[model samples]
Target: MECDASTIVSGFVEKVVSRYAESIDRDNVAPPEFFRDAAGHGVFGLPIPREYGGWGLPFSDFMDALRLIARESPSIAHIIFVHSMSAYFVEKFGSEEAREEILPGAARGERILALAFTEPGAGSDLASIETRAEKRGDTYVLEGEKLFTTNALYADTFIVLARTGPLEARHKALTLFALDKAEGVEVGEPLDLMGFRGTGLARVLLKGVEVPSSRVLGRENEGFKPAVVGLGVGRLPFASIALGIAEGALEEAVRWALERKSFGRPIFENQAVSFPLAEVAAEVEAVKALIRRTAELHDKGENILLHASIAKFLAARLAVKATRIAVQVMGGRGLLTASKVSRLYRDAKAAEIAEGTNEVQLMIIARDLAKRVR
Candidate 1:
């Protein structure tokens, strides 16, 4: 079946894909003009309600759009994903005031939102976070540090998770706030990373930052549920991004293979290079199927946590392998800085680390299996 938003997304890809890559690798930033074009094209609001200036498309369409963007620049796609995902959470769980304050700006792409869940001490163990949000009469005084927050420096808003009660409460005491980086919030310098260099990942410090009570998202002490649900929704898009990266790598490898000659014949004629390319193609297709199936489960309102984890884990592993093999197929040309395959190889590593690490996804799946057994 034809997808609803694919045609619009194709236009976006055609216009902005090459620009995204140039800005990401050379400028180390997403160009403002590129974001302006995306906003004008109704991309930022794909999942939000039409009343809120969004397209009101389903998650599947959203996933497709993200994949298309990711094919050109994963970092730009990462920025878009975080903002759209934050909008989704606010629409579902935020109070009326919170929604009204954030959704419109998000829809307009005027507000960029980032998630602040990871801490220096709590990498994947979210319950161990020490960021505290002490309640005052009509506000919360937040004091803590968040690490590895994507778009932190550039974001206008943050969905910050902070400890609200006793240590034993852990997950139960966790609360989420829709915080603006106005007064007490401080963002550190951006991280110079191995890949996804364009994403403004930074350390955020909230020093007695006062957030209005209305900024609380969802019910007090009930943040974990929406957080986990948001992750389930996010995984499919991340998998799609991985698929795009692999496809890009494969395309580059094929082009190089056809042009590069060895033994008086094109490299494509060699069994060794051709075999790996074929295998990579098959792996990408298989992962695409897995992503589609998981997306279907989500659309059907079925429990998708297990399937989401499976898709994420499989896609991440395959992306790394496929990109590596593509690089190998292109030989020395692939290792050159100017080669697109070289960029894909780096982007693939970032894909494995983002959303959730491959190791983390596997553990989540294993835990679900254990619960089923019990």
Candidate 2:
């Protein structure tokens, strides 16, 4: 029997994933120990099938687990989000042999995976990527640089996108390959960003990296569908991270307002402070409903591109708004780098840009919306 959608992953999330919430965010380097601990507790195994040594919870349950992780540390949650893109692509398109080889170690956290697609010139555009792969007798040699790889610094393997056909072929020329970082692959230092710090974010330089034919994730030159599916799956959890940020911001702001007294009474008593909190609270709830609904649709195998974009777009914007409000309520104290409010503020902005930028999401939504209207 399949696992129930609820209660399957609560314990590990509550006990193990939340344990390093403070330290994970505070440390400059992401602690490898946290990944090991999370793996030992079976957090990584939740999404894998039972046949492959995983608990095999429903996708909705996986999304719910991500929400808990996000509440603790969206940085960690963001890392998992990128990993999901790799995991999903491998599971859906990789050979049975490859799945058997990769999924078990992945479930155990012995192996970490990341996707390398974006480049300096190609942020939202996938077809224009300059990375190219040349097919030889039995291997495909790849060479190029990928920017903004969330787990590149420590990932054991990368599912990279490279041009296999021709630039004139546009997106159809793109192919996905799961290549080991062992040979010909160089991982660069993490980018100094405003948020999602310590995610092992870095540039990946692939110089003549050779991939065995078997490591190709999907049909050669036909990876566009898988890439789109990965993005769709990603939007659900990415939105959840934004949701957690909004919720955490609301919690922090409310506490700060209720305690920090003003001229006559608590700051919360002042409409100037209280009104924004109330407004943000209402908005967060709306985003929460949409997020949950989106996840449920995803679990049902429904086409969720439009819904996912709506959720992500709203969640990112709302999270940033709420975090800013939290900082406002906390005043000077919120500006401190050490404060959770400050962290939330920074992470909220990052949410809008990662996965796909808010602008990209809007473009997708507008295009889809036009179809429905016509």
Winning model by lDDT:
2
What is the alpha-carbon lDDT for the whole of candidate 1? 0.82
Each prediction's RMSD to truth: 2.1, 2.0
Query: Which lDDT values do the candidates have, in the order given?
Result: 0.82, 0.82
Model 1: per-residue lDDT, tens digit, 1-374? Answer: 22258876887778776757756765666667777887876677777887777777776777778877877777777887888887887888888888988898888888888888899998767888899999999999999999989888678899988988877898898888889987468999888877776777899999899999898988778887788778767888888888888888888788889999988999899888898889888988888877777777777888878777788888777778878988888888778876777777787898888888888898998898899999
Error of 2 at 346 (Å): 0.6
| Segments of candidate 2 deviating more than 4 angstroms | 1-19
C-alpha RMSD of candidate 1: 2.1
Tell me which residue pairs clash in candidate 2: none
lDDT of 2 at 148: 91
What is the Cα-based lDDT of residue 266 in candidate 1? 97
User: What is the per-residue lDDT of model 2 for residues 146-211, given as tens digits with 9 covering 90 to 100?
Assistant: 999988877988988899988889888888888887856899977888888878889999989888
Which stretches of model 1 miss by more than 4 angstroms? 1-4
Best by TM-score: 1
